[model samples]
Target: VQGSFKADIKLEDFVNNSAAVVQTINTWVEDRTNNLIQNLLSQNDVTRDTRLIIINCIYFKGTWRKQFEERSTNENADFHEASGNVSKVKLMFTKEKYLYGENKDLRVQIAHLPYKSDNTHVQFVFTVILPEKGVSLDSVEQKLSSKPQLLQQILNDGYTRTEELLLYLPKFKMEASFELSDVLKKLGMVNAFSDSAADFTGIVSKKDDPAGLYVSKVIHKAFIDVNEKGSEAAATTAIRLTKRRRLASDIKLVEFKVDRPFIFMIRESHNNITFFSGKFLSVPLSYYKRALRKIDVIFLDELGSEAAAATAVIMATKSISFRPKPSPIEFKADRPFLFYIRETRQNLTLFTGKFLTPTNFS
Candidate 1:
């Protein structure tokens, strides 16, 4: 079961010592989260003007039904980025029977992994929804939100059957912080943040004073660490007068490699109510190294200074088809080769080199 804590504190007592208030609140958060969250609020965030601070935190720790083998994890696995850049990542590997399926209409892949349970009746499944290589997460979310039934189908038993699954999930740790004032305003809760228009008489003693209290800022922080065993995640939301608030694929063996951007959800298997959902984007830097190419150009610098130096030089050229063609013949360069730069019209060689290796060239 997930544990959550909620509390409200007055800022008047610690008006002069904001640091102490921050430290106290952070300590409470750390204690509630098993020290997973150290500093939920900073000294700079708490001030004399901050009258009421409302805080909420949720912590979850669970073990996987089938734990991955630590030795099978590859430290350097290719993770494809949306920008077409491939980077290395610590990819956890496992081959076991898992609830898996694919949707041709949505062009998405789905996989379900249940958390360990002693009762054997209550099941909490973590489902991953991955769009095709070119498909975006935004599109998937939009489609799901518009047509809620589609989501039910994706999670239903008919869509996913037991299969021998080859899974490659990256070991990742992510911490995210956000200011949600603007988001709430955009969501049509405009009056909540406006100092003049807001009406929160029930919350604080602002009887007829329209300018008395209005949400100034809403801050939120979340963290998740996933590894061989399972996951530990914590999230905290605070409102300072503020209030406002807050892949795949497949084949025969059913290979499911989450080496790219995808969406995930933790749901109660019985009712299918999603408790937590998020998108995983951008792999760790250590996961993949970028393919780099270097170009070295040798230009005739003296040609500009000396007007008479090879003024009308011509270069020999070979034209190849820029469009479709059959398989081209392969030219292997295992042995030494000759390279020449010559003035085509004058039939005079300007430079010649014999290449045996990169370091040994003449």
Candidate 2:
């Protein structure tokens, strides 16, 4: 049976000597997974602010019952992209009897690639689902959403007979890391990420300390490689959960060329639960670049009304001088310019002047 594991460490200790701790954890993880993963946590990831750190690692190495011949692999196959572009990819070719089926309703072709089974009844299989041309994996996924049993039905009993199938699958490698805090929150996991709203008192019990711990980050990393020999896969998930309440059947020799966007999964045969599933849109998961952009936007508009425009400019000013301090005054001029000197308290006009262009001054 699987069980949960937890560990408690002082952030101060790590903060004092973060290099040692980071190196220790990274080395431990690397050795645990046979060096498939390195640098599990960076120096910045384990900082003084981090209250607690939790890590989970899983590793697997399996051999295919029938491996693809290296010499037969083709490097000139065109992989059709959803964007109507085509790229050349190395397709591993194999001719073997695979469990396969075609769902007329779903409009998809399913094939099963079984790994070498051990003494136990449980086995591991890589299932590939390929949609027909002019169709999309998204549509097939939508159909699966409605009919969740489609995968199992197709895998378990959909294929009646095993026949010689010519399979062409791309040889690729994938490594992905996801920050799932916001994604979890959007799925109704609110309190776990909320510092004030979370309740993980059971995780740590110290009445004197009232930091109100909550989960700050949940990081997941995965790696998978498929070659002529077999598949080597490993993944590590670090909760950093903090004291806070952390949170196919192949019928005939029908050609199933995976020269396009398709989905695949590494699942156990017993329960048919997916251990790792992903869409292979292209090769080298890091083929796409990461970008950060900063943009500045300034709004422009015409005031339209002279009174409003003048009022806006006056209100926006930092300084304004008034003669009597509290007295109210009104002055409106449409044409050029005008000024008047008067005895304000006695209401007597002493002088008046009007000026237009520079010609008037000249």
**TM-score of every model versus the real structure:** 0.66, 0.68
RMSD of each: 24.8, 32.2
**Could you tell me the TM-score of candidate 1?**
0.66
Q: Where does the lowest 10-residue lDDT sum fall in candidate 2?
A: 305-314
> Candidate 1 regions off by >4 Å?
1-14, 119-121, 145-149, 156-158, 207-211, 235-251, 284-362
Lowest summed lDDT over 10 consecutive residues: which window, candidate 1?
A: 302-311
Give the poorly placed runs of model 2, Cα more than 4 Å off.
1-12, 146-149, 157-161, 206-208, 235-253, 284-362
Error of 1 at 273 (Å): 3.2
Candidate 2 C-alpha lDDT tens digits along 68-135: 78787765556666556666666667767775556666665656666665545566655566776777
Identify the leading candidate in terms of lDDT: 1
